[model samples]
Target: MSLNESCGVYGIYVEDGEALPYLYWGLLAQNHRGHQSHGFAALSDGIRLYRELGMIPALSGEELKTLMESLPGRLGIGNVRYTTSGSVDRESLRRNAMPVLERGSRRSIALSFNGNIVNMGELRSSLGLPEGLSDAHALNRLLLRALEEESSIQEAVKLCMDQVEGAYSTVCLIDDGTLLAFRDPLGIKPLCHGCGEGIKAFSSESVGLDINGLDYCGEVSPGELLWIEEGSLHRERVRHSGRRAFCAFEFAYFARPDSLFNDRYVYEARVQFGMNLAERFDDIASRCDIVISLPETANDAAYGFHIASGLPWEMATRRHRYVTQRAFISKAEERELILSRKVNILGRKIRGKRLAVIDDSIVRGDTTRSVVRRLRAAGAREIHLFITYPQIIGPCFYGIDMATYGELIGAWRTPEEIAEEIGADSVNYQPIDDYVKATGLSRDELCLGCVTRRYPTPMADEMAREMWERLRSSEREGGRIYEG
Candidate 1:
């Protein structure tokens, strides 16, 4: 599966009016969080919505001008989607795109959301919506139903949370003035709020706030609800006891280097992960002639590895940075395989050398195999692969799309077998104990569900079994694994 997180959300409550320009800047800052689709809805006298299934830059200069001319509101919500839990078909794309509208009690509510709702199937069945309605669509319908029966929008959200499960950090625009924002009990997804002059803003990452010159006011507390209207902001704590299981992958691979999460800097956290990985793998560090990192994700860890192991580092691989598009993730496997050739190796560095290649982790091992083969072709004598994280033996159910164990390379094969399969002299993974300690957070503070089979929440055994079966089927179809 693709290695993208969920969606990114941004909202603005403008008191002096005309907020589209600020919204545009905020979405641009968060563009890296997702590039598949772009959407926005503004509320003035009524809700106005615009959306398209492509990158922010794909909106032509004329289209942007037309949108700016047509957009009629001071308050707006915007979303950039990567699409984790749902399909990418046209109907799914159209229906699930956010800033979704639901009319209620003579006023309409425009809602935009990030993160997944794990118990969405149960909620859909309870609401009696179409069986195939996606998680986002199900959530929109459920919120409407709750608003119909409840006294206020805040009360409706609380009631809705009682039935909903999994990670969600959302923003809802009520009529032309009010904005509502809340996070999940565990705060698995990041959401922060800021204010400046007569305007208030909220986003999935603080980088948006930084780009717009808004003052940071801290994250939306786990299960805390906030209401912004008429230049005043009110806060209420909803659910308080759920353990915080923030996805560790956020620091390891997903979030932008410039963003801040849960009061900690993301880039710093990654550097710490690399430092800890170095400590764990120090014994084997001196055996290689050179240390090279897999581009992007492993760069930080490779730095840490160098510092801890006293090894010099070099950039051995080159990446094509211009290929950002929806087609990259949604295309057929053969096309993706061809696109994989975009990564190139520097022949002089690997030629006749004993090289240690450090990477974040191996998901399906297809990319790792390709990389190893390319390095061998470049005249490498010995290739030893070191991964910063532990072997991924299970799927992630909370929000990540790695929801099936069968797709994992480590799930069915031994490390030695993986080494032989990839033409590596040896493969060493960072120990799980060291991995957890490196974060400086306890087990309760992070989600290890993807690395281990123990889910934080209690999912039904049968449901878990069915998910595993589907995972195996996908692996078989993709030819991603060799069964023992």
Candidate 2:
């Protein structure tokens, strides 16, 4: 059984005007989050949903018009997804595509969600849901169950919040034209609300709202529910765990740089991450001749390193403009080919230079190794890696694809060992404290489970402990424990 996936979700409720256009642009802006599939759900007389494998296509004028005509509604939600959950085959990808719609005897509902459910097995047993259901399906079923038992949407959501475990940022569209959005008590994923003329919207990232000309309202607070009906938006604090465990990976890699959290742009935080790296690795900085990033995500950090270290930041590697999919999110079998075609190295510029190469993170070392080989072939005399995120030492019970100890290159190796394994002179990961400081968020407020091996949720923490013990022994670490 495949687990869950990290995805991007967008929902809009407009008092006037159609919601499809705004939802389209909103999801499009967040295409970087997931590339495997794109989908949309609109609420007209009833919910109309269209989902397909692959990114949202660049529609021609006529095609856009046809899409608009097909899904006419004043409220809608959209999703872009990549699988860490379910099967990755074409058939499964089509089956798992969202926004996921569930029909019941009394009412039907549509949902678009990000993050995983840690206690899915228990939930399934308790709710009597069958196996082979995607996390989104399980969640929707759980909500439907709650809705059947409760008197109001708020009460149902509160009950679900009390029962469900793990990271989830969700948006729901009820058949009665009600639009609802909520985050888990821990706020382990990103979800925010925005407003515009006669419109209220919810997106997994602030950049989504930015693209749609919406005013930045605020985050849908941890455990808070926001619903819109009869042209009015209502807020309710369903449950608060008295703490926040926002995913730190968002700032390190997943989110678009322009995304905002706590009034600070992710780009600015990444730049600060570079400065922190420079300060921490001054010795390495002194020895390096030039700095170059591993294309787009690391570009900001590379610039920050140059700014602080007085080194020249070289644009020695250029990403293919048309190759927009992220290698980190791609399947392992396809990653090497994608990276080879996605980035081009300017060999002449770095033919003899000792380069400080910046990157977001080194997951399995395939991407880093491939890039290092290309750099060596391009005549880079020396390569030193500066990683923005700390070393990932365990599986992520949330939504990240780093699922097993054996899959993570840094899980059993030190920085020096990893450097040797990846063909680099050195590997410098941003320190935990420095990373938190750079993000402008407190240490207790961020989730560092993948790096620290200390999860915020109870089940995840226990699962990691058991997985670690299995990995240490000769026992075969089976599939994702969450699925187990």
Candidate 3:
């Protein structure tokens, strides 16, 4: 399916010196987060920016050097956008590209955003914009309009939040020296701050900070605004909407293992998830001979699964770590073939074994089907598929683009049917209660809307109907259905 959420973002404010190289490295470290586009803006005497809708490594040696050298500022912001809300069509693609630059009353603002905004339609209608306005454009317009009346950039951001709703963790460069950063009231997306030398940086993942040798300050709290100028940072809690709901997917499937979320390590969380899964399936532990993980997102949970079950674990599938671009699988048939090619089965490890495969989640049955087929082909006596997350029975209305109910395999098929389709001896998913508990956060602090469809933000009936119609048309057009 066409994956919707983008990965990570990085921004820096360095003393009057070249910051593009640092921004480039930051983006490089975050390259896994987004491969579709890369861009950076620097402000020295004026705003100098460079961006292209392609992978970072795709830039020719000379092209890379030219963009790096041309960037003119000590203060800069960079974004790597993965299309989540819009289509990949040419017009939609261009509209979703980020570090959206705009000229404001006080100065120029180059905004780089990471998360999806759910209320774009309502916001557009309220702003009196055209019906066809994309979320990126609508957001840019809202930010600009807020700036028109507010005193400072931070105030403008707070005022803008009142108009739009949904998950957003954003960074904006205002004028040549000032930087503004904010996370949504729910803080469903991650945004963190770090300091290095005379440089201060903000990123969606802490790995960006570690790559740049920056000291982690802490995460930017929800409903807060940060302003950075001349290597110094100031913070103001503009809106005190204490309600916070961090996206659980960030820990389960999105953030880098080494990254930290809300002061908790992602790798640790996965280990905890595995521990919880082990306890839930304690009786099945002795029936499995070995535990194997579907790398690399499932590696941590697999590790946890192994430790909890006391099962001897081996790497049955080898992954080519360098493949960074999104694997485009157009059809279900093609998806199965591509998945098989992506992982190589170690016959010696799987032969004559009763294996347990630990995976992050089953968005669709294609990838899991391929993996199970390869394992059984290698003489695996039996295979049990364990998903770290519960069945995703509904679409995510917040930001994640999970397919509609009709397309979700879990929505129509039972566990037995899923097991049969995937050719597994049995299929088990983490219970929703256990999954929520594993995060060590309250229910209200997490968004389980993808699994339950009880969206935090109200989804109007008309919008839901429109989305359903779109899904139906997409099915007719033979587009990849985004089941979770």
Best by the TM-score measure: 2
Top of the candidates by lDDT: 2
10 residues in a row with least lDDT, candidate 2: 475-484
- CA lDDT of each prediction against the hidden true structure: 0.74, 0.89, 0.75
For each candidate, give its TM-score against the true structure.
Answer: 0.89, 0.96, 0.89
All candidates: CA RMSD in angstroms?
Answer: 3.9, 2.5, 4.2
lDDT of 3 by residue, 260-324 (tens): 87777888888878877877887776799999988787888989988888998888878766644
Summed over model 1, clashes come to: 0
Residue 128 of candidate 3: its Cα lDDT?
74
lDDT of 2 by residue, 428-449 (tens): 9999999999999998899999
- Candidate 1 has its poorest 10 consecutive residues by lDDT at 326-335
Deviation (Å) of 327 in candidate 1? 10
Candidate 3 TM-score to native? 0.89
